[model samples]
Target: MKNKNLSYKFYVIMSLSIAAIPVVFIVLSYAMFFTHLGITSLFNIDNHFSGSVLTTYFYIVFFGILFGLMFIAAKYFKKIIHRINTMEQTVRKIAEDDAFPEKLAVIEESEDELNKLAASINTMIDRLRAKEMELSQMEDLKREYLKQLSHDINTPLNALNLELYLYSQNHNVSKEEVDVLYQKVDYISKLVNSISSEALFDIDNYYIFKEDISVHKSLKQTINKWSYLLNKNNIEYTIDVQKNLIWQANELWLDRLFENIISNIFKHSATNQIVITVGDTLIIKDYGVGFEIDRDHETTGLSVIKNICQKLNIQLDIESTNAGTAYRLSQE
Candidate 1:
């Protein structure tokens, strides 16, 4: 495609038009000397007519040529303006990155530079559309994978939970720490149930349009619901949350994220008390046996928590090298 700028081709046309003037005058001058050219001879009018009649003929011939040239220039400029309009619309649509319409032919029917430029742009846009389709197909594959994973994990966990429940009650365990094992099994089962639906695994879309929610309120609600379990486990916990610390999040998802983390803290850590400090960031510190970072069995909860924190742009800081684990969240 040729460059669309007027200077690219229009200058050539204008220069030719200007250069033709001297050549045209020279041709007329020779014609006048040899053929005795006049309005009468040029138009084959009556030679006997002279003075005022001859002057009138000359005026008519001069004005007729002038009007013809003017008309041609006007028509040329009008076509150029129309091409400019078409190119403008095409460029705007491409810049907007709108999907190209079917049968949307951006053809360069004219041999003009502007039309050729538009045709080139349209060709590039076609290439982009192909890549876009490929990306879309890849996204579909990802969704299917997540959906299949969820379904595969869902059905088996229920039966596993029933087996574990029976084992916890019937086995007559000697160790008090057996409660932690049972708790881990039950929480994992619940986590499986919650994520059984493929829609919730849409981490990419979830945080994009997350609504503003009360971090403190959701935490309190989740804590209240889990109070019975905490008491049964005899795990002491502290809450020091700032009033009305709002964050952009899905409230239910945030609650679930906290539930998984807290449940793991109670199950894995030999903590007498866990302290939660909510200010600029929400912090959960457990003063107990520190996590090995790699030996934890609550992989399901950890997976869910990690996905949520990452999607929501929430910073998840874990300190596990010390006597306990500390999880802190901040806005990214």
Candidate 2:
């Protein structure tokens, strides 16, 4: 792979042609001298042929060599110009379309400066495409996350509003009711902080903040928080999570994971009895009309749940039928 620049090629051709000039001139001078002597001595001919005939021969030879050199230079330069033109057209096309192709055409046979430039452009296009894909995926994740976040925030907000309304009607708020309000307010505050700080969206920090958390405690607290809605709907539920069941997980994300699961149960599982067990595995079964898993169940809540489970290395399995729906989550 001998790469050559335009200057190097041009210099080589020009140097050879220029260096032949003195040699050609010296050879012509000797030929003219010997021809004049030989013709006059051997044939007794006149010396005027050197001026007329030999001079004409010299001019013809010199012009013929000049023409041959020019022809070679033209042919070589033509190929270089064509390559340059092709590169220019490619660049113009990309600029006009405002997009990069997957690859650039490179002349592998000739490792010239132009080929190297093309290879560089190809590398740059690959990097740009990768960056584009990353940004696009992030945008999609952000969009889905925001949808799920709004849904999660709405539950506590509605509870808080309902509690406030009840207090206004009675003109007296009980201690338990006040505690519930405080908890709802605290949860909403955390949601706001998480949103403002971009905690959930920050991939590097969110999944790394793990700790040992009691499964029973977290589930119990989530159920208590959503008690207002469950009671209003008259939905009966049972929990079998052991107090000793502790898992190493991201506490905030675990809370969110449970919250989304419960919220989905409340919204989609139109069942009266909900059973949750956390022993060797976690299972949330509802005795309601189940949904078809093969359908487009791309709800924000489910998306959030799946995202959390995937990032936390949790395996999720869903079973659904006309009899009921059950979601099982376990460590893998």
lDDT of 2 by residue, 242-321 (tens): 53677778777787889888888888878888899988888889998888775736752677788888877788998988
> Which pairs of residues have clashing backbones in candidate 1?
none
Candidate 1, overall lDDT? 0.69
Least lDDT summed over 10 consecutive residues: which range in candidate 1?
101-110
Each prediction's Cα lDDT score? Answer: 0.69, 0.77
Relative to the true structure, candidate 2 has a C-alpha RMSD (angstroms) of 11.1
Angstrom error at residue 304, model 1:
9.3
For model 2, the stretches where C-alpha displacement exceeds 4 angstroms are 1-170, 199-207
Q: Report clashes for each candidate as comma-separated counts.
A: 0, 0
Q: What is the lDDT of residue 142 in candidate 1?
A: 69
Which TM-score value belongs to model 2?
0.55
